[model samples]
Target: MADRKEQDALIQQPDAEAEAEPEPEPEQLTGCGASALCDPRRKPHRFLVLMLMCSLSFGSYFCYDIPAALQTQIKQDMKVNSAQFMQLYAWYSWPNVILCFIGGFLIDRIFGIRLGTIIFSCFVVVGQVLFSFGALLNKYWLMEAARFVFGIGGESLAVAQNTYAVLWFKGRELNLVFGLQLSMARLGSTVNMNIMGPVYDAVERYIGVESYYCLGITFFIGGVTCLFSLACGLILGYLDKRAERILHRKSHGTEKVIKLSDVRYFPLSLWMIVMVCVFYYVAVFPFIGLGKVFFEEKFDFSPTHASAVNSIVYILSAPLSPFFGLIVDLVGKNLMWVLLAVSTTLGSHCLLAFTFWNPWIAMVIMGCSYSMLACSLWPLVAFVVEPHQLGTAYGCMQSIQNLGLAVVSLGSGAILDMSGYFMLELFFCACLCVALIFALLLYLINLFQGGKLNLSTRERRKLEDQSRS
Candidate 1:
């Protein structure tokens, strides 16, 4: 121990000397036109700008899910059946899945986040106006069209948020920021579930009739919120411009080319990870869409009571995500956590499948399963992908996941109609089983391959040492 301490002291000696060395001449330091006395301790104003951007992005993206939560109310008001109501959810997801990759490319190459945010905000605004009209006039086709267009906008914003977070927050509390952003969005979903019911009730009472007035108001508010988000984007663009100028002057205007080949494996691993994400969401999100109605019908509860119970999942999920992220960062082994989370999720589904139970008890168990999966699974993408490719990888994953959700939503609706019961729960349980099998296969592959993917040599050494000890 003494020798090891001496060796550590010796290793740090050179760095101490370097700090003690004489300062360079003023001309040598000042040639780049940057201040030598810039205080690293002072916080950058850019962080504040980025936070606002993230908040706005969260608000806009969440509007996509809000409509789905209010589906039954919308259907009853519009006099449409469950099949037609389900199509609205499909419209919201389908365009996003189809155009997600393209959104990523545009964000990385042509538009960057500034133009992308603005362009996408327009789509959201236009879609909201059309949706508001449909709600007021009881035009189902128009509502579906609005949902499709809104999805394009929301998908672009989703990609932009992930990309922007990677660019602006890398190596500086990135895990915390990612978790916080996600939690905020889930908070939006929580709010939608809990508050929308009361709001809809009030709106229906106020409109002098029982109608889909709340849906119209919700879309209108979303449109206005999007405009606010666009303004935040403009501010972020300005700050980015200022930061770029400072960096250029400091680096003597030399352009740095980051080689994409160095990160090729990142994208490859991300593709497999996205497949995992798709299966996970396929097993989960449709249940979220149908949760309230299913619980109400299965257990004979009021709509408000059902929604409140379902809201527990989102509420519990929001706060737990950050802790899960901290665990991943601290442990530095994502695969084990992924396996554990998926295993627990599978068990939860199996329990739900095999038994008939009270709605509250079932929701609690489902919420726990979803919380584990939601928090643990997403951070794995950051582990597998390069920092530069985060946007593309996240976008690709979102696209695939959205596709699965879209298909499952439509199929589950048809199945529910045909089977004469809410069969989505069983179908989703089967999907979870498949996901568990895939997770096991991925684990075995990593085990045989010496845990090379995502794990650095140092990390592997630590794991091996821990095992031996």
Candidate 2:
């Protein structure tokens, strides 16, 4: 009887142990799944996400440059001088000084990337509509207010865009990804510069030339682009959510709350980069903002010709940025690329300011260099900062950049009005020289810090492997 009881106990123990053992998790998909196109980790899906992310900012970029695109009509119809015309850009930059930083924080803290993108996109649509209405009613104040609101969305959306780029592409294809994004953004701007003038002219036939209503109608067309961007935002959110669920991605954000104190720990090299952003971009953007008129007045070009020339920078950037980005990725030496970009840009400005060459030559050179700078410069932030702190870091850089843009937009307008385009170009050259100086400082700092920022993709990967080993 004792032997029989022991046998039963042993059988029961085996049954209990089997029940307690956990089942194996189902095999997770890491590569092209059954449907490769639908697999989030696959290249096709990543390309889709990249396209959506890049298109996400298309509307804002298009609308933001509307004033530049139709500068002649906006100023003439609205009865504003060069200074007040620049107020359009100044108002756009003003609120972004603080709001963009908050936007980045919110992306990190409260709202994740998907939700943040949608909300900012909505702001763009609403602001554009209000801007159109203001033009219809011929209220300059309302137009400025609309631009202020538009800016709030526009710049924040950019921060979110940058965050998304780093989130998915961080090590793989990061440079080309950024380059593609710049390409799409410049495409939007180029489309605006080329089409807005024709759009205004077409609208003018019905509403009459120099009518604010005509400007209003032309701007309303831009709202359609915003709507398209908003839709992309929605689809991207859904895809991102689906990917997160399937892939169990834990890199979105950390469980630990981000603190302002984190800023203190950021390296000094990042601050120098920030200053470089401020100085370099202040020269470029403000010039583009007021470029149409400068081209018309200086080069003796017709309105159509001036618009074409003014858009050349964006035209070159649209197709070339991605290529330049690929080169930067393969070659590395991002600081050297940055230095080359600034020097070339300075030379271009000198040509425009001092020489009487075909404006196209100078514009083409500026365009290519601008593309190189964008691909090389923006990615530096991702290198110096941790993933979790990317939002804050990018936000700070853009905020300070907006501040510089705001001050300089106003200053450039004043200089243009009082001094002339030649002087305005000189002002730009000076800003670039200062930027070059800072770029040099950054090179020295990076050199002493082991030159990680300047390493090619292969070298970086090898170094990372060595560290891990």
Candidate 3:
């Protein structure tokens, strides 16, 4: 133990030394001055890129939760049990367990970010089309296959999306950018939660209540959103390419590339962060996937009201994330924020499991906690890993997160089938308990190693400048 602590102390010194080194200044603007409207270095142009990057995953986010939005309808129309219904989400996650890493690697090695983003967006479009057709034909097996395809593009696209954010926004407004991305993603989910039910009803009204037909039409409409995202991906690619040309920006391909063997050398804090990501999200996402039905069964809510309650988490997230990001940026005790998120989430689950108070209160608490966790947690990876390895590192995080979500989603369904909502909530509480412990371990390790993870932005900047001098 003593030797291990000494080794970590040795590692911390070099890590700080590496971070303290000064970086090259940006290349001079060529075609236009920095203040020009069309200059990529200008705030407006960067904001445009940010907006497009945020929208890149909006379609996938909207369609991914369609099954959950219309859970009761899907089960009844498709004639599948709870476990079978959850298989929609599970299949989406299963492929990502491996494919997301490959996708990230391709971004780093094979395809540059621009091409990678486009290809993954195309995959999302194709998968959504197939999924809609499967529903139209009432073929459950076909829908599952389509979900597998969608998962490949969906999760990988997220990796591409993160890389773009870091590439353009890092060290300046990364936390806010990540927050905005999460907000947009949650916005898509929230829109689907509230809109799908009404869309289904409208289709049913027009087509005289053919169950599978209405479902097919509803999902097909959702596919339009995916198409919109693909358009954004194309335009964003063009803009990024143009910016690179104008600025004489060099690609990371010219630098030391990420290798498979690099994973073994990742800091211990990175692994601990990954553990927190896996355990914390397994509780939140699986619950959301199954929450609508739980609200209906427990609170006796009508489908619309139940969906409204179920979607509160997303609704709150959309508005709260940017605000929380600003806080994390200013405060910068990321591990503390994570611990708070886990603790609040655990409390929220306990309230639902043990009490009969208004569920809105519990959901609201959970929602804010989720926003904090996301904005704080994800940006830590950029801080810990090298810029060249960001794609691979983000991909690894998503892959492991998907694995947890896939397993727990299926297990949550079975627990619902076998035990009931109370037991299921307890299971989630247990997961949060595990997450909280990991978070504390992370805090203690960082403290012993040098306390870099807990430093506020101002202090971090001061430390960097001092080290450089």
Candidate 4:
């Protein structure tokens, strides 16, 4: 009876279709499962939603790099040594080390992503404003206080961004989503590096070349960018509220709150992910923070060219990240990709530390690997824990990552101050080598687990249930 009814309906559908254009052939489903699973309504909104995620953090990222770009200038203006300069970075990261975890906990339990984003965005704006004003005054302690305040918002806002991506893109093209977010982030940093020197030069014509007001105005522009981000956050919150109301989606907060004891349930793979994050960033960020100076000293590049050289990693990342992500989404074997990323990074640092080859080549290779490893790694947390714990999972990862950044950055600054760039290179190289080891361990863990973690989207669906975890 069902067959006969289907045949009759097929015949009847011809008359209906004849009046309309022919339907296009359906595209093959390439993600983890059939389109039957995800909401067709949500598809069109995903990219817009992702844009919101990306832009809401843009100012924070842009502002984050300004001090590094003006590292030498700041030292001269404040009459601070490298060790004192390191305090700026330390203050920015250390408080956030504890705050991000609590922020993540709040996102998971109390405030939802929307409200959390707004509040954190506010923190970024206030902190940037304080930092800018402090720069104008040339008060070192005031600047340090401003950094501490900005740190309150900066990383927690990042955690919110990651949580937003997971909430919307979970289990479906999440690697690509993460890659895009990262691209935007790197683009922000890239733009800051490329433009700030010129911006300083341009402003110097009006403010005088050595005036503290130049840095003040530059950072004030950054604060305006944060205002733009805050506006976007408000819009995003409204749109999300509308979506939830119309879709009757489960409000994530109403679900089970994350108990502190949930840490016991995290898989070994998750811990491996955290370790890799800590080690890898310790090498990359500290280097970039010091890169312009490194190039000026080692390669005799001009300040402008040195900033360009230093920014090569971010320059490559802006375009290549999504490409790497697409490859990972299609190819899977995420752990292998991570291993490749870590290995390349270690090689790049070694090239910088030991040889005289063009640093640009090393940076390009490291940039590609940076995107690959990052996209591959973050998504693994989604795989390791249940959906509800994702905020804490990301929080936990960022917390540890912040700690590594704080300690390594502080130490590397001191090394550069006392020992010279060679010692700093050695420190960064050692960190990368440790990161490489963790990547290898991840591969081994996958091997021992029947390689389920490595299977392609099409393959994973064949054997396992397609829940978020």
Error of 1 at 258 (Å): 10
Question: How do the residues 166-200 of candidate 1 rate in per-residue lDDT, one tens digit apiece?
Answer: 55554454555666666766777787677666767
- Estimate, for each residue in 24-50, the C-alpha lDDT of model 3 and write its tens digit: 455676455555656786788888888
**Model 3 / residue 2 / CA error / Å:** 44
Q: How far is candidate 4 from the true structure (C-alpha RMSD, Å)?
A: 9.3
Give me the displacement of residue 270 in model 2, in angstroms: 0.6
Off by over 4 Å in 4: 1-42, 251-254, 464-469
Clashing pairs in 1: none
TM-score of 1: 0.81
Clash count of each predicted structure: 0, 0, 0, 0
Model 4 — TM-score against the truth? 0.88
TM-score of each: 0.81, 0.92, 0.92, 0.88
RMSD of each: 8.3, 9.7, 5.7, 9.3
The residue-by-residue lDDT of candidate 4 on 1-469, one tens digit each, is: 1211211222112333433544443334446433332322456565666788788878888888887888878777778888788778888899878888888777777777788889999999998889988888877788889888898888989888888777667657778988898898889889888887777778878767556778888778767878988998998787666555434353112234578789778889888889999999988888898888889989999988888889988888888888888888888888888888898888998899899999888888888889888788888887777666766788888888998889987898889888999988888888888888887887788788875667787787665453322
What C-alpha lDDT values do all the predictions have?
0.64, 0.86, 0.86, 0.79
Which candidate comes out best when scored by lDDT?
Answer: 3
TM-score of 2: 0.92
lDDT for position 278 in model 3: 93
Error of 4 at 112 (Å): 1.0
